[model samples]
Target: MKIAIVGTGQVAAALGKGWAARGHMVTFASREPGTERVQQLLADAGPNASAARVADAVGRSSIIVLAVPFTAVRERLEMAGDVGGKVLIDCTNPIAPGLRPMFDATTPGGATSGVEQIAVWAPRARLVKAFNTTGAENMAAPRYNGQPSTMFICGDDEVAKGATAQLAEELGFEVVDAGGLSAARHLENLALLWIHLARVNGMGRDIAFRLLRR
Candidate 1:
């Protein structure tokens, strides 16, 4: 799989290293193409990975990962041309800084979740929300505590979600179907709880999410 990560942040860097380790053709892209961080990632990724412009990276990749902040997501999407007809994975949590509140199930219009906004942006792209539930450090590791972590994914397109789940499983996570893309709001907020856990306790990224059932 040719995967292009459209950010230089921790999430993108982690995915780049992990996917490259999985033998995927991975590229890390940055708005500033010649930045030291992008150069370092290219060197770190070795021959299997390279640095590219956002549009070029999105064009070449079978899957494009939006790992940037929630506020910056739309701008980045616009920068990546014709993201339609590709598997677009969004790992964003629309978190307002210092807003220690919970997720509002209703949209500002009080109708639906905010994830639908992405749908409006890339009508042709098959968007799935995954990897947002887990920490950045955990992404690079294939396993945790001798067990596989569960990656919960959701999207309107079943085929796209299927592909996303397969990729998650290939990356060594137990993929759990979490219904439609609207569920992404809830999933994104799930991070708040996880972050709170990290704050209240001393849990690190080595800890992963697992859904235990009867």
Candidate 2:
């Protein structure tokens, strides 16, 4: 798969490396693709990874991962031109100043959830909610105690969810289908809980959630 990562940050770089290692071409969409920092980051992801302008990157890839900060997502999506038919994966969580939940302020009541709100920004794209619940360290290495950590994903489109699930599994996660786009509310809350546990409670970044069954 040719994956276009819509950010040059840690999360994007980590996922880019993982996907590149898995033999998927990764193109990082950035404002300054000619910069040394962006070039170095792409180089680290391997030879299959490169950098391009936001719109150009999205135009060239089948899968688009929005790994940018929540506040910048809308602007970035707008810059990506018409991304109507692409598999757009939302990997951002609404975190406001002072580590507060930005959803209350930014997300309208009728939007249902952040992912749904994001869908409005990119209405034509098949949006999938994923990769926002854990830290970048956990994203880079999802295994602990010889077991893979669970990655919960949800979307209105089953095909989009399936593609995101396969990508997550390829990166060493136990993918869990967390139902439709409405489930993004709970998933975002889970992300806040994870942030609290890792940062406030000092559980650290090595910890991850696991689902067990009989």
- TM-score leader: 2
Per-residue C-alpha lDDT of model 2 across residues 68-171, encoded as one tens digit per residue: 88889889988999989899999999876666666753456667567888888888899999999888888899999779999999999999999999999999
lDDT values for all models: 0.80, 0.90
Once fitted onto the true fold, the runs of candidate 1 whose alpha carbons sit more than 4 angstroms away are 99-103, 109-114
Query: TM per model?
Result: 0.91, 0.95
Model 1 lDDT on a 0 to 1 scale: 0.80
The lowest-lDDT stretch of 10 consecutive residues in candidate 1 is: 105-114
Candidate 2 residues lying further than 4 Å off, grouped into runs, are: 104-109
Q: How close to the true structure is residue 43 of candidate 1, measured as C-alpha lDDT?
A: 80
